[model samples]
Target chain A: MTILFLILAVLAIVGASAAMAFRSAVHAILALALAFVSLAILYLSLDAQFVGFTQIIVYVGAVAILAVFAIMMTRSDSAHHHTEVFSKSWLTGLVLAGGVFTVLAWAVLGDKTQHAAADAPAPVTTVTQIGEALMQRYAFPLEIMGLLLTAALIGAVVLAMPLLSNKSGAKSVTKGDAR
Target chain B: MTPLNGYLLLAAFLFSIGLAGALTRRNAILVLAGIELMLNAANLNFIAFWRYGTHPEALTGTMFAIFSISIAAAEAAVGLGLILAVYRHFKTTDLDEIDSLKG
Candidate 1:
């Protein structure tokens, strides 16, 4: 089990790095999907069965597919081949990320309590318990989340909706020729 | 069982990688994907801590993960829709090219 977990973690990190490393949008999305799958496996190993499955369905089924659909919809002029990153920008990002990782590594390594925590056997979480908690203690937040999703849906429709008049049609037509 | 530090360090690396992707990438969809990665890393941390924490019976962390996924879904929908809208009006998805709003 430990070896399996380690392998999945390494694979996940590789997939995430590939997501960042790739220049093509399609390839990046593929790598992102791979990372998500590995993460779901990691979650399962940790006994987070419900969350793991949710990760698979949401990330693999919904978000990645949504991104691919968006990519297809907007690929008018071979847009996927666009220069994906700036040289200085990625260097700066790497430097910043490395610094943060060093800090986190230092803190995690220095903590003694974590060693004790790791020895305890992990408890299995049930979907019924999670459901009860959400419906009871977290009922209000759940409703708010539903409301938020509804609002976001409406907002997306509004933003992506083409104007009924000729003016918005003009914007769409002029898009290709516009300098 | 894997060491708690191992999971913690893994989560840290996942977050850092996601941060790099978000900071460096120019493509709007990739940026959103990076943000999703970061969110998932946080979720991983939540589950890990819950698994090893004193109160493993309480499903608070799992509850949070569910909520986070829902929020992320909403964010992706709105963000991609905005990307489509910008592409329609500006004729480009490259953030560098869409500079008219840089007043």
Candidate 2:
């Protein structure tokens, strides 16, 4: 079980890195989907059934599909047009990322002594326990999250209105001219 | 046997890749994908710590991951809407050519 977990972890890391490195949006999304699945597997290995299922459903099913849809909507027929738009400073990106990684590594390693006790077996965080906490203690935050989702839906409708109107308006203008 | 440090290192590597992608990507949508990767990296760390460091009483990590997933959904909706709006006006989703909004 431990070896299987280790292999999955390594695969997840490699897949995620490939997702980030791929220039093509389509390829990147595919890589991300693989990475998400690997993560779900990792969750299973950790005995986190709920988290694993949710990871598959949310990341692989919903988010990845959304990303693919976005890519399809924006892509043009000509390869030249697509390539022309993605010019950026790759070297600076690498340096900045490396610097951030080094800092995070230091922070994570700094409290090594504090984490030595953590090497022991801890109780598994089950779904029922999490549900109880959500209802009993963090109910307010959960309610707030619902409100936030409502607000986001309203915002999406408002943002989409212009495009919807423009398409219908163009049709009307053409019809009026035909008349 | 896999140690907690192994998970932490994997998380760090994933995060670094996400950082690089977010920094270098020109398309707003792709940048959003990069952000999602970074968020997942953090989520992995949360779950790892919950499994290894604390007792079952600290299920904060699991709850936080759920919340983060919902937030990611909301972000994607708004972001894609903005992308559509930008495409309508500019007739393109290229980030470099979107300078009119810039001061």
Span of 10 residues, lowest total lDDT, candidate 2 chain B = B1-10
Candidate 2 achieves a global lDDT of 0.76
Judge candidate 1 at residue A119 and give its lDDT.
Answer: 48
Chain B of candidate 2 vs. true chain B, TM: 0.89
Worst window of 10 by summed lDDT in candidate 1 chain A:
A76-85
> Measured with DockQ on alpha carbons, how good is candidate 2?
0.55
For each candidate, the DockQ is 0.68, 0.55
Please list the residue runs of candidate 2 whose C-alpha ends up more than 4 Å from where it truly belongs after superposition: A76-86, A114-119, A163-179
Model 1 TM-score relative to the real fold: 0.89
lDDT (Cα, tens digit) per residue for candidate 1, span A80-128 = 3645464346788889989989999899888866334444776866788
Per-prediction CA RMSD (Å): 3.0, 3.7
Q: What C-alpha lDDT do the candidate models reach, one value each? A: 0.84, 0.76
